[model samples]
Target: MYTRILVPVDHSDTSAAALAEAIRLANEQHAIVRLVHVIDLAQFAWSANEFLDVPQLQSSLRESGEKLLTERVQQVQEGGISVESELLEIWGGQIARTLVDDAVKWKAHLLVMGTHGYGGLTHMLLGSVAEGVMRHTHIPVLLVKATESK
Candidate 1:
């Protein structure tokens, strides 16, 4: 019964699985897919050195994020699913928060994302984005766990 499905893709294999699942669901339900890719400059801030300009790095990151979103959007569209996409840039804060906000903005009925399937110490240390979204978002979230490829 979902009219809009929000998918957060990060150009990872896990994310690919999530997107594929979203597309299949969208096709089945005759819904629209809203794909998002967030460019958080904070991730690269520490890598910025005396030789690198923060502004330039941010721009580069935005470009790559948009490219990733575009590729996903194209794939979804080709699958006969109605699709739209956005490239977001946030200076700080968790990516999960950003996706939740975007889901509200787009009036998404569902959220689909990829989880790394980490537990215990690793989960505590890395902090799971999928877990954060599941905890904070109001809509139903479907998490697809991605594992290492051989």
Candidate 2:
């Protein structure tokens, strides 16, 4: 019986599936759902390198992240579910670390995420956020493998 469910969305199709699952679980348990979107500062840093002021670029990134979160929050709220949203602009580090930190901070009972199937070399080269979260967090995690879109 989860009272607080955390759903991390990156606007990907896989994430959308995860969000839907989270909503279903929340609805059944009458739980509160928290939607979190972490803006990878590392990605923004690359953009900053091309510009003059890094700080200014960071600010712009934060604003964009906030806007994206706000729109998603609105959509979730419109579904008639009790929801809270967060847009975290964390400095480049580890996505898994950031996600687990937020889950603990919010006291989330469950974590629902979508897994973008990555193979050996690909998985090794591009770290899997879900894998990191699962390894570090004690909370229960339900991973939904990405479904093909028709």
Candidate 3:
């Protein structure tokens, strides 16, 4: 049984679905769930125009990530699950690597995450973090694909 469950989430239906699954598993195993939200300030800030304020954009991203983590933590708590959360802000780093590192650092028994399940051209353009985690991590991972209605 998974005594420590790690769940990485974002502001997406896929992520929400993954959190739901994590909560269920945590309840079943009487485990503690650690929710993580990663914000890549470098990628997001550089994607904007030169006229945009980089510092301001980074701050906003951090705030947004914190809000998302707070909300998700509340949701998990409401489910009567033992939960904690972390908002990771990276300048320019691999998200999957960060997740894996966190999972290892936390001694998580299982890492649960969501996937959009994009294929072909879309997947090539938007690289899959879940796939990367699956390929790189030695820890067990649970991938929850977003449903159409979600």
Candidate 4:
């Protein structure tokens, strides 16, 4: 009986698939969908050091994040589903925590996300965001894995 669904989309194929699934489920139950995109500030911060100036770099990154979210929101709205979208530009270090916090704040009954699998050294080096969200959030999570590139 999920009435409020939170779909965290990153414009990835897996996320798109999850959004489609969420749309179907929402339509069946007449539920509200909240689309969220988290802009990892930490990643931006790190990249800022490589740029000419921190302020300029951060500004560019923020603008890009906003544009990306807006486009995705428009796409979702076109599907004839009632939707609310949020763009959370949080410091990169606390992405997992911030996502859980937002989910609770939104009072989401379920969270749908896409997972890009990491293996070997990569997996160990960059931990799993989906796993972190699953471990921390009280709401149920539906993870859709990306299809292998042919």
Name model 2 segments beyond 4 Å from true. 42-53
Order candidates by lDDT, high to low. Answer: 3, 1, 2, 4
Clashes counted in candidate 2 amount to: 0
Model 2 alpha-carbon miss at residue 53, Å: 4.6
Q: By summed lDDT, which 10 consecutive residues of candidate 2 come out lowest?
A: 43-52
Model 3 worst lDDT window (10 residues): 41-50
Candidate 3 lDDT tens digits, 75-150: 9999899999999877799999999999999999999999999999999999999998998899999999988963
Model 2 TM-score (2 dp)? 0.88
Over the stretch 68-128, how does candidate 2's per-residue lDDT look in tens digits? 6787677667767899888876777788999999999999999999999898999999979
- Once fitted onto the true fold, the runs of candidate 3 whose alpha carbons sit more than 4 angstroms away are 44-49
lDDT of 4 by residue, 1-150 (tens): 888999887757888878888888888878889988777656655653865576777677778767877877777677777898888877755677778899899898988888877788998899988889988987899887877778
Give the per-residue lDDT digits (tens) of candidate 1, residues 48-144: 3667788788888988998898888889989999898988888887888998999998899999899889899999999988988988888999998
Compute each candidate's TM-score over C-alphas.
0.93, 0.88, 0.94, 0.86
Assess candidate 1 and give its lDDT: 0.89
- For every model shown, the clashing-pair count is 0, 0, 0, 2
Task: List candidate 4 stretches off by more than 4 Å.
Answer: 42-51
Clashing residue pairs for model 3? none
